[model samples]
Target chain A: MQTLHNGKLTRSVSLEDRGWSLGEALFETLLVQQGNPVWLEEHLARLARGCERLQFDFPERALRDDIHQLLSESRDDRAVLRLCLSGDSLGVRGYGAVSRTPHRYCQLAALAPPVRQYWDEGIRAFVAKTRLPEQVELAGIKHSNRLPHVLARAERKARDFPEGLMLSASGLVVEGIASNCFIAVNGELKTPLLDRAGVEGIVRQKVIEVLRTQGVTISEARLTLSDIEAADELFFCNSLIGLWPARQLDCLSFSSFSLCQRVQKELESVWYV
Target chain B: MQTLHNGKLTRSVSLEDRGWSLGEALFETLLVQQGNPVWLEEHLARLARGCERLQFDFPERALRDDIHQLLSESRDDRAVLRLCLSGDSLGVRGYGAVSRTPHRYCQLAALAPPVRQYWDEGIRAFVAKTRLPEQVELAGIKHSNRLPHVLARAERKARDFPEGLMLSASGLVVEGIASNCFIAVNGELKTPLLDRAGVEGIVRQKVIEVLRTQGVTISEARLTLSDIEAADELFFCNSLIGLWPARQLDCLSFSSFSLCQRVQKELESVWYV
Candidate 1:
C-alpha cells in the first residue's frame, strides 16, 4: 500500500500520534481509474467546506499535489483512494487556554476496489434504528464523526441484511449507511434533502446533474419509507460504489431497476475519469 | 510518553492503522490521585454502556487492569489519565459484509492537569452557534463523534471567550463546549436532560448527587438561553476541570458564586480519590 502525506510519500505516519482523533478530521474516499480521480475538484471543494465548518485551515495546494503524486506513482487501473485531513490537537487547554493554532496533516492512501457484485445485481437493505441527528451546523459536511453510520451498518448486519437505510431524527429516510439513496416515484427521481442530516454525497449530486441534463426532473425532497415503498425503483450511490440498485428493502422488493441501470451506466461513463 | 494498549504496555500503536476511526471509539478521562482514579466505576460503567451501544465487546477486566497499570507506573500524584477504546474497522465492506469481530485497542495516556486559573476565577462563556443534534441513539454516550465540541471551542476562541455554551437543534441550552452545564434559579439547581442531547459527565452527576444528599433540590430539565440569562448563577462541570463558575455569559453577570463554591468544595473533598 502506498501513502502520500502532504504531497510527500511516506510509509511511517501516525494519525494518532498528534492527537488527531478521526472525529476531528475530514476525509474523502475516491475511486481512481488509470491514475486519475473522479470528481477530484468537487471532492476537494467539499473537504474545504468541512475544514471551514470544523475550523481547520485547508492546505488546498499541498493536498492537490499529494493527490497528483499518489496518482502519478500508482499503477492500479481501478482502486479506492482515501484522502484524510487531520486537524489540531484538542488538548487539556480547554481548561483556560483561549485559543489553538489549527494544523493540517493530509494523508492519502490507496485501497482495494469495492466489490463488484453490489453494483451488478444490487443489494439488500434494512431500515436501521440508528438515526442521524439534526445538527444543522455539522450536517452535509463529511467530517469523520460517523458513529451513526457505523451503528447503522452494525444494525443492518445484526439483522442479516447487506446494507442499511438511515433515518433522520425526525424519522425521514435520509440515506444509506454509506451511500446516498434515490428512488423513482411517478417517473420522477426523489432523494432525501441533506440540509438537515446526511452527507452531501458527491456521486449523488453527479447523478442528479446527469439526470437533469437528460431532461429527467429529480426532486431533492424529504423521502419517507412509505414513499420508497411506492417507488418504481431504488438505488444507492457513493463515490466508491458508483451505484447499487436496491433489489430489496426489507419485505418491499424493488425489482424494476431500469432507471437505476441507466443512471449507473451514465455514472460509469465518467466516474473512472 | 508511555502508552498502554489493552492492559499491556506498548510504545507504538496507530488507531487508524487497524481501520479504527476515532468516532467508533469510546473514551473517559479521569483525575488520578495517589494511584487512585476518581469515579472509576462510574467512568467504566459509562464506557461499557457506550460499548454496548456501539457494539464493541467491552473488555472490562482488561481495561480495569490497564488503568491499574497506567496509574501504578506513573509518578504524578495529581494527573489526568485518558482511557480510549477504539473498535474495529468499518471495512470498505459497505457493500455486503455482514459482521466484524470487535477489536479492543484501548489506549491509556497520561496528560497534564488542566490549568487552575479557570477554576479559581470564573471563566467567561459565550453561546455557540454550533448546536448539538438530537440523535437519541448517541445523545449521552461519550462516543468520539465530537466535531461539534471542537467547532464550538473554536467559535469561543474566535469570539475571545474561554468557554462556549452549546444549544440543542431546537434552540435549547444543552451544555458547555466540553462540560455539562448547571444554573441556579430561585434557589433551585437546574440542568439540561441528557436523554436528548449532551454528555452525561461524571462530575456533573457527582455534583447532583452531592447537592441532593445535602437536601438541595436539582432539576434535570430542558433549559434555554432566556432561562440562563435570568439565572442566579451558572457553572460548568467536567471530570477533568471539576467545576468552573461562569462569571459572565455574554452580558448577563453572575457575581454570587456561593452555590457554585459550595458544590466545588464538596466536589474537591472526594475528586482526588
Candidate 2:
C-alpha cells in the first residue's frame, strides 16, 4: 500500500504512527483504469470539499501529483485508490491506496451483483420508517459518519428490497442509503437538494451536468413521498453505478416508463462501464 | 494491545490486522479503570445492539474476554479501550487502545470563553439553531458514523460556545455533541430520552440510576428550549467529565444554584477518579 502524509510518501510501519487514530480523517474512493484514474479531477474536488467541510487544510496540488504518480506506477488496469486525510498534533493530512479486488466479505458479500442489477433495470424502493436528523451544517458533505446508512441499508435488506429511501424528520425525502434519488415530474428532472441532508454524489452531479447540456431542465428541491409516487419516472444515481431506474416503490411501480428508458440509455451511454 | 477472536487468544496475525478499508466493522469506546472497565456490560450491550442494528454478528464472549485480559495487564489506572469488529476474509475482531487525553484545536484561534468562569462555575446554554436528523434505527447507539457530532462540534466551537444544544428535525430537543443534556425543571430533574436521536451514554445511564436510587425524581421526556431556559438548574453530563454546570446561555444567565452544587458533590463523592 502506498501512503502519503502532508503531500509526501512515507514508509510508515504503523497506521498508529499517523494521526488517523484520533478519527480525524476524511477520504475519497476513486476508480483507476489503465494506470489512470477516471474523473480524477472530480474525485479530487470532492475530497477537497470534504476537507473544507471538516475544517481541515487540503493540499490539492500535492495530492494531484501523488495520485498521478501512484496511478502511473500501479500495474492493475482497474483498481480503487483511497485518499485519506488524518489530523494529529501536526495537522490534518494522510492518504492510502488499495488495488481493487473482489474480497470474500465486504467487497463481495456486502455488495452483490443483484444489488448492482438495480442499475441496469431498476429498483423497488421503500421509505425508511426512520427519519434522518436534520443538521444543515452536515447535510451535504460526506464525512464518514455512516451509521445511518448502515442502519437504513439493513432495514432495506431485511425487507428484501434493492434500496431504501430515507426522509428528513421534517417529512421531506432526502436520498437513498448510498445513492441519490431523482424523479422526472412534468418532463423536468428533480432531486432532493442536499441543502439539508444526503451526499452530493459525484455521479449525481455528472448526471445533472449531462442532463443540463441535453436541454433537460434539472432542479433541486424538497421532495415528498407523494411527489415521488406521482412522478413520470424515478431513478437513483451514485458514483459507482452511475444510475439505477426505480421499477417499484412500496405498492407503486413504474417499470414501463419510456422516459426511464430514455434517461437510463442517455446516462449509460456516457457513464456505464 | 491484547486481542481475541471468538473468545480465544491465538498468535494468529490476521486477528491483529486492520481491515477497516473494506467497511465491514463496528466499534465501541469505553472507559476502563483499575483493571475493570466502567459500565462494561452497558458498553458491550451497545456494541451488540449496534451489530444488531447493522445486521452484523456480535462476538459477545470474545469481546468481553479481550477487554478483561487487557484491563488486567494495563498499568494505567484508567484508559480508553476501543473494540472494533470487521467482517473480512481474515476474521472479524480487533481491539486497540485510545488516548485518554482530549485534543483541542481552534478554527481562528480559540475564541474567548463564551461565558467567563463557566469553565469552573458552569454556564447556562440555549438550544442551537440546528436540529439533529431523525434516523430512529441509529438514534441511540454510538457508531463510527460520527460525522454529525463532528459537524455539530465544529459549529458549536465556531460559535465560541462550549456546547451546541441539538434538537431533532421535528423540533424536539435531543442532546449535545458527545454529551447528554439535562435540566432541573419544576423542582425535578429531567433529561431527553434516547429513544430517538442520541447516544444512550453509559455515564448518562449511571447518573439516572444514581439519581433514581437517591429518591431524586428523573424523567426522560421531550424537553423544549423554553423548558431548559425556564428550568431552575441546567447541566450536561458524560462519562469523561462527570457533570458540568452551565452558567450562561445566549442572553440568559442563572445564578449558581445550590441544587447543582449538591448534585456535583454527591457525584464527585462516588466518581471513579
Candidate 3:
C-alpha cells in the first residue's frame, strides 16, 4: 500500500483531489523480475502512447527515473509495479502503488491450466452471446473504461470456461475476454484485425513479431465463426499465459498436431525456455 | 473535496485493504439543488439495484441517514453528490464525496456540445461503424467498467458530430455515448429496448414514466438505422441536459414542428413549469 506521487511519498489525499474521479488517469502494470521490471522500456513507451491517445501530458523521464529508484529499494525479485498517471490542470505525472503483500496483488490462483490445455487434446468454446461495440478512436488503446470486458469476463466465469470469444454486433469474431485470438488456417496464422475494436495487447504484438521472425506468415483479417471452425488449430495469446490451444468450440472441435506443437514451442522459446 | 467512508471520514485507504478494488463498489451521482440533491431517492434506488446485481452487501438505511446528515452541512443549494460503496471481509458500506465548490464543478461550458446545433434542430444519425457487445448479465447495469462508452464517446467526438448512434452488432440501435436516444416515427414514440446492451438510465426511466402517465404511447423496440433515418424526429436525453433535439446527422435533416413542441412541452412541465 506504499504510494508515491512524482517520486515523493504522500499521505491522506482525497482520491478525487488526486484526480482519480476525473477519469483523467492512465496506468501501466509491469511485471517485476529479479527486482527489475521486464520490458521496462516497452511498458514506458506504451504508457506514453496511451497518454498521447488521451491527450494527457506525459512526464516520461521523471517516471522512468522514479521506477529505477523504487526498484533499487525493493528486495523482492519478482513483483508487479503499478504506475498510475493522474491528470492535473498542470500536466500528467506518474504515481506508484505497490503491493505490500505481493501475493495478494500479484499472484493469482492458478486455474486448472485452462480448457486450452485440452485443445491439443480437444477443448470446447462457444460464441458468447456478447457483442462488442465498433469504436475506432479507442480501438487499439487500453484505457480504464473496461466495463464490456468485465461483463464478458463475468459471463465466462459463470460458465466455468477458461476463455470466451466475443463477436461484434455484425457477427464478426473479435477476440477473447482477456487475450488476442488466432487461428492457424491452412497453415497460415490469422488473427482478427483490430482496426475497429479490442485492445492492441503488447504480448499479442510481441508474439506476432516473433512469429514473423520465425518465418510464419501472419495476417490480420476479419474472422467469423465459420472461419474459426474451418481452421486447423485455434489458440489465444496474452502476456501472462503466452499461448492457449483451443480444442472444441460449440460443437466443432479441431485437433491439429503440427500447428499446435509449432505454436507451443514458439511461445515456450519466448516466455519460458 | 471531502470524503466519507460509511459516514466516517478516513484517509489513505487501498482497494485491497478496503476490498474496494474487488469490483464491489457501487456509485451514484445526483444533481444537488440548493444544497439538496434532486431525485436523491431515485439515485439511491439505482445504487441499491447495482449492489443487488453485484451481490454485494449494502446497508441502505444507514447510507440514506448519513446522506441526510451530510447534506445539512452543504453551503450551496446546487451541487453534485457522489456516493460510492465498498466492501471488505467486514461487510459492505457506503462513502460520500460532496463538492465544496459547487459552482466551479457545476458550470457547463459551451464547448461544441457533442453534435452541431443544426442536429439539435433535428438530424439524422446513422449507426456507428462500431457495434456494442451484448452481455445480458451486465447489459443494463451501470458498473465501474465503462470502456465501451469511452470508446463510443471518442468515436463520436472524432466524427465531429454532436452525437454518434451505437447499434448492437445484431443491428439493434442501443444508445448514445452518455445519453439515451429516442425516435418519433409514424405517429409512435420508440426507443431501443435495453434488454441487451445499454444502460437503464434514471433520467431515461423518469422520462418514460412521465410519458406513460401522460398517456403517450411509447414502446421499447429493437430499432435500426434505417428506422431512424425514416423517422420524423430524433432526440437524445440525459439527466444533465433534459432533452436535446438532433437537427442534422450525416446528410439527413428534419424539422418537425409537432415533435419539437411535444418534447419542449414535456421538459417544461417536468422542470421549467
Candidate 4:
C-alpha cells in the first residue's frame, strides 16, 4: 500500500524511530468517504490532546498537506485513513530524551469487508481476559502502545467471537476491543468513565452528541459486567465502522435493539457523509 | 553507529511495521564488553518468555545470526547493544492480523559516558505521579509499550531527580523507571512484587540469584511508599547499570548501606565481567 511518510511518498522510516522501539506515539483511525474525512477536526483535536500529554508537538501542517495531496486525486468512499505521529527517536536509549521533532506517517487503505458486515449484522462479543490497566497518564488518548487490545482481539478471534470486551484490571467493564461500549440502562445511555483507562472514541462522542441533541440522556458511569447484563440494549461505536449494534454478548442474545437501531440511524447521516 | 536489520546491514524498516504503528515488539539492552554480550542466554530467555506471552514466535535463528554477524568484527569493551524484535507490519489495519514474520533490528554503539558516572555516584530518587497500571497481562515482560516509564522518567527529569520510582495505581510501589527496586529491612532484601505491573528486569533476576547464593535473603513482597520510607537501605538494579545505591528518595536521606553494599559487591563480579 502507498503511504505518506512525513508528507513524502514512501513506506520506510528510520529504524530508530521511537514509534518502533518505545511506542512513544499516538494515532487516529478515520473513515474517508468521497475524498473527505467524516470527522477530521474532531479526530485532530483528540490527537492534539494526545500529543500534549506526550509532550509532542503536533505535525499539523505536514499531516493536513499529506491528507489533501492524497485525497485530491481520489474519490473513494469507505477508505480508511490511519494518521500516526510521534516525537522521532528514543535518542539512543536515553529514556529522558523525549524528542520534540514529530514524525507523521499516514496510510489510506480500503476499509476491511468485516467492518461493513459487522456494522450491518452487529457482532458476537465475549468478555476478554486481557484487562486494561488503570493508567490515567495515557487514558483517553489513542496512543500506539496497544498490546492489551491486540491480546484481547486475539482472544476474541480464538474463541470465534467477532469482537471482545475488556475490563479494567480491577474488573470494571471499560470498552470493546476497538470501540467504546455503550449500554442503554433504564432508557439512559451509560458508558464507562474514561478517567482511568480506555480510548475516548470520537464516534462514541458523536453518538452521545446526537442522542443528547435528540433529548436522549447519556452519561459516563463506572460500569461492570452486571451493568452490561442488566442493560436493555448494547452497542459499540468507532471511527471506522461507525456503529455496531450488539446482537449477542456471550450467551445472552440481544434479539431487540430499539435504541441501538436509533443510534445506527442517527450515525448513518454523518458516517455516510 | 553500525546497524543490522534482520541479520543484514541496513538502517531502515518498513513504516507499515507493527512495531512502528502499534508497538507490537520486544527489546533487550545489553552491555557488549570485549566482543561478548553479558548474559546473552539469560536475556534471550526472558525475551522468549515475553514472546510467548505476546503470542509471538521468537525468531531465534535470525536473531542469533544477526548478533554473531554484528559482534564478530567488533571488540569494543564498553559498548551498548540494543536488540529489537517484532512481528512485522500491522496487516492493513486489521487488528486481528497478527504477523508472525519477525523483524530484527540491532544497534551497537559505544556506551554513553553517563552510565559510568551514574554507576559510581548514587542517584536521587523521587516518587512519580505516573502510576503503573495494574495489568497482569503485560506485567513482568519488557514489551515495547513503555509510555508509563517514559512519563515517569520525564517527571523525574523535570524534578531533577536522576531516577524515578513508580507506584501501582492502587498506591503500591512497583519499580524504578528502568530498574527493579530493592529495599533492605532487618537484614533481608525485599522487592516489589511484579505480578501486577513493571518489567521483571534481567539484572533483578541476577541480583536475586547472586544474593540467594550468598545466603542473603531476597524475596518479592507488595511494597508501599511507607515501606520505602521505613527501609534500612534502598537501591536500584537493571541490565545496563548493575546497581545504583540510592542516596536520597524524595527528601529521605540514606547514609548507611550495609545490605546495599553487600548486594552490590555480590553483583559487581558478574556485572564487571
Candidate 5:
C-alpha cells in the first residue's frame, strides 16, 4: 500500500509519532472511481470542519495536491482513499503555552469487496448493547476517538451480523457501526439527528440532500428501534458502499425496498456518479 | 528522550505501527523518586485490566523487565515514566477480518513541575463545557481515547485556570482534565464514582484507601456542581500531583487547607515514601 504523509509519499509511519497513542486524529474516506474521488469537496469540507472543531487549521490546498499525487501514482482504477489528519500535543508542556497543530496522511488501497450483495439481497443488522454519549464537543466531527465503533463492530461480528446499530444514552438509535442510517416511516424518509451523537457522514448528507431536492420529504430526528420496525423500508450508507438495505434487524424484516431502491438510484445516478 | 518499544530501547518508531490512529492503546505514568517508581504494581494492574477490557493480552513480565532496565539506564533521581501500549488493527481487512494486537512503548521524561503552590496557596478550577460520555464499555479503562482531555486542557488554558472539571452527560461531576476530584461535604469526603464515567486513577484509588484506613470517611457518589458548591472544602488528586486543594471553582471559594494538608502528608509518608 502507498501512503502519503505531510505531502511526502511513503510506505510506512513511525509508531512513536504521537498520533497512534494519543488518538489526536481525524480522517475522511472517499470512494475513488476512474481516478477521481467522488464528493471530494464534501469530504474536504467535513475535514476542515473537524479541524476547526479540534482548533487546528487545515491546509486544504496542500492536501488537495497530496491527494491528486497519490491518486496519480496509484495503479488501481478504483479504490478507497483514506486521508488521516493527526495532531501533536507538543504545546501541552503546561497550561498557557500549548500548540495543537495537525499533519495529514493519505493511504490508497483496493476497494472493499462490494456489499452490493447487501444492497441487493438485503442484510442483517441489530441494535448494539453499547451506547453513544451525547458530546456536543465531538458530535458530528470524525475525530479519531472511535472506541464505540470498534466495540460495536465487535458486537456485530459476535452476533454473526454484518452491521450493528448504535443508540444514544437515552435509547435513541444513532447510527450503524460504520454507516449512517435512514428509515422510511409513515411515507417520510428519516435519519438520526447528529447534533448530539453520531458522525455526519458525507454520503449520508448527500443522500438527504438529493432526496429532498427530488421532492422527497426527509427528516433528521431522534429515532428508536421501534421506529425502525415501523418503517416501510430501511437502508445504510457510507462513501464506499453507496447504500445497503437491511432485510432483518432483530425480529423485524422488510421485503419491500421500493423507497430504498429509489434513494439508492438517486445516490448513484445523480450525486455519486 | 529515550523510548523502549516492546522491551527494546529505541530512540524512535515508525508510523506504520498501528497504535497511532486507531486509539487502540493504553498507558500508565509512574513517578520515579529515588530510583523507585511509586505504586508500580497498581499501575501495572490497571494496564492489565485495560488490556483485558480491550481484548488484548498484556505482557506484564516483559514490561516489568523493560521498566527496570530503563530505570537502570536513567540518570535522573526524580522523573516521570510513561508506558504506552498501542494495539494494531492489522486484521481489519476491509470489514470482516481485522486483528488487533498491541505493542508497548516506554518514554522517560523529567518530572513535571510540582503543583505544590496549588497545595500551599490553592488553585482555581472550573466545570468544562465538554462532557464525558457514559460509556460502560470504556468507563474506567485508561485506553488512549484522550481527545476529550486534550480539548479540556485547552479549554482550561484559554480560561486561564490551572485545571478544568469534567462532568458526565447527565450533569454529574466526573473528574478534572487530568485528575480525580474530591470534595468535603458535611465533613465527609466525596468523589465521583467511575462505574459509569471517568478514569479510575491509581492515586485516586490509593487516596480512597488511605483515607478510609485512617478513618476519614470517603464516599464515591454521583455529584453535581451544586453538590460541589455546597461543600465546605474541595480538592483534586492524581498520581503526578498527589493532591492539590482548590481555592475556587467558578464563584465558590475556601481558605481552609487543614484536611488537604493532613491527606497530603499521609499520602507522601505512607504510600509514596
Candidate 6:
C-alpha cells in the first residue's frame, strides 16, 4: 500500500511484483508544469477508477506524497511524472496476489521536445496493423496491459511516422498509438467510444468539456475507417500532447483544423507552463 | 538479450522496466522436479517465439544461466521456476524502447501442495464473467498482458470455484483461467482453437502429442458452451498441474474421465518427478 512514510523512497521494485508479471496494475502519466503536477485531481481520480477495475485499492495519500516528493527534488520546470500502483511484493504462486496490499511508485522524467510543433503543423499518421480487441471490463481505464500500444508505436517508428490510428478486428477505428483521436465530419465532432476498447484519455475528456461549453456538438461513437476518411478535419489528444491535428493519414490529407486549433488554444495553460 | 554473465545476479528489478509499467514482457513457468526443470527446451523455445512477436531478441544463454543459478540455490526438490524476460530499464517516453536490450529474471517458489489430488478427484469450474478479447497478434503466447486471466481467477475465487472457463466476445469457449481445456464427446477429444485468443498451453500440447500417438482423435476447433455441455468428459491441463479432469462445471456434471486417466498415465514422468 502507499503507506505514509517519513523515510526515503526506494527506487527499485520487487522482482515478484505482479505489475511486472501480469500487468496487474494501473498507471497515470501526468504533466508537471513548473514544479506542479497539472490536473492532479483528474489524474488521481482516473487512477482510482482504474484501480477499482483492477481490484486494487487506491493509495491516494501515498501517491500524492510521492508526486510531491518527486517534484520537490526535480529541477526541470516542465517534466513528465508517471505513477504506477501495483500489487505489493509477496511470495508468488500463480496469478493470485498473496497479499491484497499494493506497491506505489512515482518516477519523473524530462518532457519530450515542444509539443506545440505537432499542434500547429499537425503530424502524419497511419492505420496501425495492430488491432484493439474489445474487452468491455478493461475498457476506458489506463491500466498497464499496453502491449498493443507498444506494437503500434513500434510499427509507427518502423514506418517512420510519428503516430498511427488503431482499429478493431472488425475495421472500426478506435484510437491512436498513444493518444485518443477525434474527427470532424459534416461539421460534427466525433471521437471513438471507448466503452468497448481504448483508453478514455484525460485530455480528450477536457477537450470535449471545453468544446461542448463553446457550443460545439461532440459525441462518442463507434467510428470506422470510412468515417475518418471522409472527415473534414482530424486531431489527436493526450495529457502530454494537448492537441495534435492530423495533416495526413496514409495517402489522405487534411488542410483544415479549426476545432483542433480552438481546443489547443483553450488548453494551453493546462498542458504547458 | 540473454547475454552470458559470469558474475552474481541482481535480485531487484528496475522500476522503469516496461514489464512493470506496460506489461511488455514474456514469461515462462517451468516445473522443476528434483533439481531439474521439466520441459526446459520447450519452454525456452516458446519464450523465443514470444520474443519474436514482441520485437525483442531472446536472451537464450542468459536465461539458461539464470535457471541454473536459481535451481542450484533452491532447497525444494519440486519447485516452480518463473523466467521473466522484460525490456531493459530506459528513459521513459511513449511506448518505444530506447535500447533494444531486455532484462531476464528467474525466481523459484515452492510448488503448491501435491497436484495429484486435483488430477485424481478432479475439480469444479464455472464459466467466468470476464471475456478474453480476440487478440490474434497476442494469441497463443505467454506474454505478460494477462489482466483478463487475473480477473477470471479473481472471479473464480469470489464464486468459490476451483477454476473458470474463459470465452471470447462471441461466446466461444477459449480456455481455462490458468490452463487449457479439452473435452471428449462421442469418442472425439477436442480442444478450443487458439487462433483468435487464449494461450497454446505447454501441457495441452503434450497431452495432444501423447493422445494422438495412442490413436485417440483430438481436434482443435471453435468450441461453444453447448459443445462442452454435451461432452462426455472434460479436463484441464498446464505445465505445473499436468492433468486435472473437471467433475463438474457450474450445474453440469460429467460421469467419466477415462481418456483423461489414459493421458495422465502416459505423461506421468513428464509432470511428476
- The number of the candidate with the highest lDDT is 6
lDDT digits (tens) for residues B1-273 of candidate 4: 678887778868766577777778888998887778889998889889888887778888888888888888676777878888776655556566457666788878877433555556677889889888888888898888888888887775633677888899999989988888999888888998999898888888877887788888888999898999899888888777778888889899876667667666766755576
Worst 10 residues of 3 chain A by lDDT: A96-105
Against the true structure, whose DockQ is highest? 6
Count the clashes in each prediction. Answer: 0, 21, 38, 0, 15, 1
Off by over 4 Å in 4: A112-117, A269-273, B113-117, B269-273
Report the C-alpha lDDT of model 6 over A1-273, residue by residue, as the tens digit: 121122246666766678887888888888888888888898888888888888887778877777777777788877888887787547656776566667777777777545567878999999999998898999999888999988878876733577899998767889998899999987778999888898888888888998999999889998998899899999988888778899999899999998988888888777665
Those runs of model 1 whose alpha carbons end farther than 4 Å from true positions after fitting are A7-22, A90-117, A158-160, A269-273, B7-22, B90-117, B158-160, B270-273
Interface RMSD of 1: 4.3
Ranking of candidates on TM-score, top first: 4, 6, 5, 1, 2, 3
List candidate 3 segments past 4 Å from native.
A1-3, A10-14, A17-26, A86-131, A156-162, A246-273, B10-13, B17-26, B34-36, B52-59, B85-137, B145-177, B181-188, B222-236, B243-273
lDDT of 6 by residue, B85-182 (tens): 78864755678877666777777778764557688999888899999989889989889998998888877573356678899987899999888999
Docking class of 3: incorrect
Per-residue lDDT for B38-129 in model 2, tens only?
Answer: 67788778877776765566766656666666565667655556666643323221111121111111011111112325435785455566
Q: Report the candidate with higher lDDT, 2 versus 6.
A: 6
Segments of candidate 5 deviating more than 4 angstroms: A11-18, A91-97, A269-273, B11-18, B91-97, B269-273
Candidate 5 structure quality by residue, lDDT tens digits, A1-273: 678877887655544344665677888888888778888999999999998987878888888999889888887767888888887545243223244556778888877546557777888888888788778888998877777777666665733677888898888888988889999876679999999888999888887887888788999997887888789888888888778788888788877677678777766543244
Q: Candidate 1 chain B TM?
A: 0.89
- Docking outcome class, model 1: acceptable
Of 2 and 5, the candidate ahead on lDDT is: 5
Query: What residue runs in model 2 are displaced by over 4 Å at the alpha carbon?
Result: A1-25, A89-120, A156-162, A260-273, B1-29, B84-120, B123-130, B155-164
lDDT of 3 by residue, B149-223 (tens): 444544554334656778875778998766688888776788899987887877777767767776678999989
* Winner on DockQ (2 vs 6): 6
Q: Which 10-residue window of candidate 6 chain B scores lowest in summed lDDT?
A: B1-10
Q: For model 5, state the Cα shift of residue B10 in Å.
A: 3.9
